[model samples]
Target: MIRETYVLVERELKKWVGRRGTFFISLITPIAWLALFGKSLNFVNMFSSAGLQGANPVIVKQYVDQTLLRLFGTTNYFAYLATGMFVVFAFFQSVFGGVNIVFEKRLGSMNRLRMTPAPRSSIFLAKMAATLVRTFFYETILLVIAVALGFSVDWNAINFIEAGAAIALLAAGFISIFEAIGFAVDNQEIMFSIVNLINLPLMFASPALFPLQQMPWWLRDIARFNPLTYAVDIVRYNLLGVHSFNILEDWAILIAITAVFVTAGLLASLRVLENY
Candidate 1:
């Protein structure tokens, strides 16, 4: 199984590396998003909307500063927003990760593989592993762009390693879930539609773009069960020293969710073999 997995991983990596244009485009996208949405969005009004009309500037400044510290662990909104983009990108990776399977099935590669002795799980695992590598690379490039854009991502080596691990877990878990959906569904259009439908809601409803406290009661309640919320919290705590939940509990929840999805995805992948 290890050898088979390695072979598939290598093949997938080569395929990915061959797409230089796609790699470059992916690297550019998050930076563009940070520039357009992260830097441009105005959150000042939300802070001042507490009917503090006659409040002194000094009081406002202090209150805002304290609020920022309490919520995001920094007064820099750009940094907070930039770090959250990692979570957004993670979802993007997961959403598209399984499309390759559909393509493989269309190309007859999946059919050929299913006839071989290679474990079906290894094939999907190889794809996930390849995507994990891509996710790490994406994070590294995003961090560089973020720093260039004045996003404070000051973290020690230990925290940086932890962040990377958290991202790996996030990508694996999410990719697996999507692969499960991909395996079950034959129509690529439906998968594409599902991705489009979930992306915006998941991204906005989570703490990735905005603090949970700032959201309405209903949205906050919804975000409480969002895996992206825990993933974002883990990344924020490690990368930006910002945390909204207990680190241990966040990791625990993320891992638990990942385990469930992984199990489901494996079963789905094995079930897909019968179709071929």
Candidate 2:
């Protein structure tokens, strides 16, 4: 199983690398957000008004300074945005990977693969492994750029392990949701529209840009129900050492979401196969 999965994963990875345009398009939004939005927004300045509006000027200055200090740590704005960018990349990659299977169906590749003697589970797992591997490469390239621009990372083994686990779980959950969507939808154009329409809203609705405590009441409630919020929180906690919730609870929620999505995706794939 492991060897078969790896072989499929390697093939998909090569395909992804060959599609340079797809990779660049996938990366452009995240890069723009980090380089342009992060610099323009200047989160510190945006929050300054709140502190200044308070009773004491001295207290406001102290509060603003402390908040900025905590938010940025020793790194600059790019590093702060990198956490959000990583989540965005993972979400996009996994969701888009689902549509590839549908495309393969149209191209007759999926039918050919289905005729092979391998277990259906192996086929599903291989696709997922491919998606996860590609997402990791996307993130690694982004991180390399970030580090070149002076993002600081703690090089401890625990941080590396935790980061890898978080990325894997996030990719798995997102890919599962997308795979289910792929099976349910027949029109590729509609699928693309639905995915794009739903993507940015999820980012904005989550605590990706600001802390949940700072969000408006309605958005806060929405974020509470968003699975992406837990993924973002977990990634932020591991990569940036920032915490917006109980660590254990957040990890459990992420894992649970991954499991549910995986089961749903597998069932959907099975049904699609049986129908085909």
Candidate 3:
């Protein structure tokens, strides 16, 4: 099964790499958010322009920086937002992980794949592995861009690995769910509709774009139930020293939820594939 999964994953990655246009185009959205939107939300600059320039500029800067520190755990809002975007970029890629499966199914490749001796579970595992590889590649590029745009982080190796692992698991969880959806559905449009419906709401509802404390109570309640909220907390704590939840608790819940998602999604996809 491991060998079969490896070959299948290689095929998927090779196919993905061949599509140069799509890979580069997929990068534009996160770059825009990190470069333009990330820097634009700086509270220090906002307060500076809001007539606080008349006061001793140093005092005003200190005041705004301190307030931002309290609100975001760092005075550099771009760093806060960039870490969030790291998880979010993985998110967007993971959400689309099953897109190729949908296409393969439609083009008769899925049925062909089932004719092989490879276990149905390997089929799912290969797709998940391949998507994670692709996601991590893009994440590396995005991180480089973030660094160039004034996003700072602890210069520590453990922090880098932990943040990467947190994102990989989070991406795996989402990829499993979407991969099951790909196997279960016949039409590509249904997969797209589901992605569109949940993607933005998930991003907005979590601390991905704003602090959870800044949100209304009802919204905060909803975010508490979101796996993304935990994922972001884990990433932020390791990468930026900014977090809302206990690091250990966040890891526990994230692992529990991701375990459930992976189990359910694999079983469901295998069931659907068996029927075909």
Q: Write the per-residue lDDT of candidate 1 for residues 186-209, one digit (tens) a residue.
A: 788988888888888988999887
C-alpha RMSD for every candidate: 3.0, 3.9, 1.2
- The candidate that wins on TM-score is 3
By TM-score rank, best first, the candidates go 3, 1, 2
- Across 1-276, the per-residue lDDT of candidate 3 in tens digits comes to 999999999988898989989888889989999888987786666788898777887888899889889989988888888989999999999977777788998999888899999999989999999999999999999989999989877789999899888898899999999999988888999889998998999999999988999999999999999888998998999988889989999999989989999999999999998887
Best of the two (1, 3) by TM-score: 3
The Cα local distance difference test for each model comes to: 0.82, 0.76, 0.90
- TM-score to true structure, per model: 0.89, 0.85, 0.97
Answer with 2 or 3, whichever has the higher TM-score: 3
Candidate 1 ranges with C-alpha deviation above 4 Å: 41-67
Summed backbone clashes in each candidate are: 0, 0, 0
What TM-score quantifies how close candidate 1 is to the native fold? Answer: 0.89
Evaluate model 3: give its TM-score: 0.97
lDDT value, residue 205 of candidate 2 = 88
